[model samples]
Target: MKIIAGLGNPGKEYEHTRHNMGFDVIDELARRWHVTLWKEDMKAEIGQTLVNGEKVLLVKPLTYMNNSGEAVGAIARYYKVDLDDIYIICDDLDLPPGKTRIRKKGASGGHNGIKSLIAHLGSENFNRFRIGVGHPQDGHTVVEHVLSRPYGEDIQKIEDAKIHTADSIESALKDGVDHAMNVFNPKRKG
Candidate 1:
């Protein structure tokens, strides 16, 4: 079984905020796949489905952002899923809005959620699908920037990124992670 977990704080106030980018992408995928029924399991909301004959679990952790691993670890253990089959979606403050990136393995890059995942999983070998939320600008703290919703053009940019993230995950499911990375990852100008 494949586990696709999206990191976010669970609450109406957190909806569509920059910090909830992971949840936004999962919600997009769920909508596209018609996964309307979500059940609580392992401290998370789970939507089950099949993609290319592979059983997939769409998970939304309810342990908030900082402690997401508690839920993810439990689900992974319960299902006996391999680390290679786990995909984590989360927001990235390093990249500008409207961009996304896929990494097979990496450190958390200061993301509390990913940090928790690494702590619980006992490895940094799972897949990551990151949506850029941009860095905190002006006098705004990182917390304020992430907890708030985007405005004006940034709002549209984030919405587009969410759709792109979902498409990339679908591609990863159908083709392979390498193929998805090649297609979705932006080229760096060196």
Candidate 2:
């Protein structure tokens, strides 16, 4: 079985913030798979279904962003899922807006949520699908930018990123990370 954990804060207040991009992607995946995220175990809202004949557990941790690992580790332990079988989707500020990157494994790069997961899992060897939210203009704090909502063209870019995140996740589950990376990492023209 594979576990996909989308990291973000819970509650309506965090619904559309840049920090919640992970939740947005998982929500979209649930919608596409016709699955209901009603199960309330593992400290998360979870949906179970078969994607490409593979048993998949889609999770949105309710422990919020910083403590995301608690929920994810719980689910992983319960399901006997290995680190390689787990995928984390979260927002990245280093890449330009609307861009996405899929990495087989890596450090958290100072992301609190990913850091928390690493602490709980005791390793940095997990797949990650990072959706770029872009950095703020000069003199803006990253905390402020990530907690804020996107506007205008930025909003459309965020939406597109979410869609692509879901597609890449599906590809990863169906065809492996290398295939997903090859198909998704390059720039695409409209």
Tens-place lDDT digits, model 1, residues 1-190:
8999999999999999999998888898889888999999889999998888999999999999999999999999999999999999999999898789999999999999999999999999999999998998779999999999998789899899999899999999999999999999998789
Q: How would you encode candidate 2's per-residue C-alpha lDDT over 1-190 as one tens digit per residue?
A: 9999898889888888999999999889889999974799878998999988889998999998999999999999988999999999999988788889999878888899999999989899999999888998667799888988888698998899999989999888889988999999966679
Model 2 residue pairs with clashes: none
**lDDT leader:** 1
What is the alpha-carbon lDDT for the whole of candidate 2? 0.90
Residue 53 C-alpha lDDT in model 1 = 95
Candidate 2 differs from the real structure by a C-alpha RMSD in angstroms, to one decimal, of: 2.4
Error of 2 at 107 (Å): 1.0
The deviation in Å at residue 51 for candidate 2 is 1.1
TM-score of 2: 0.94
Pick out the ten consecutive residues of candidate 2 with the lowest summed lDDT. 34-43
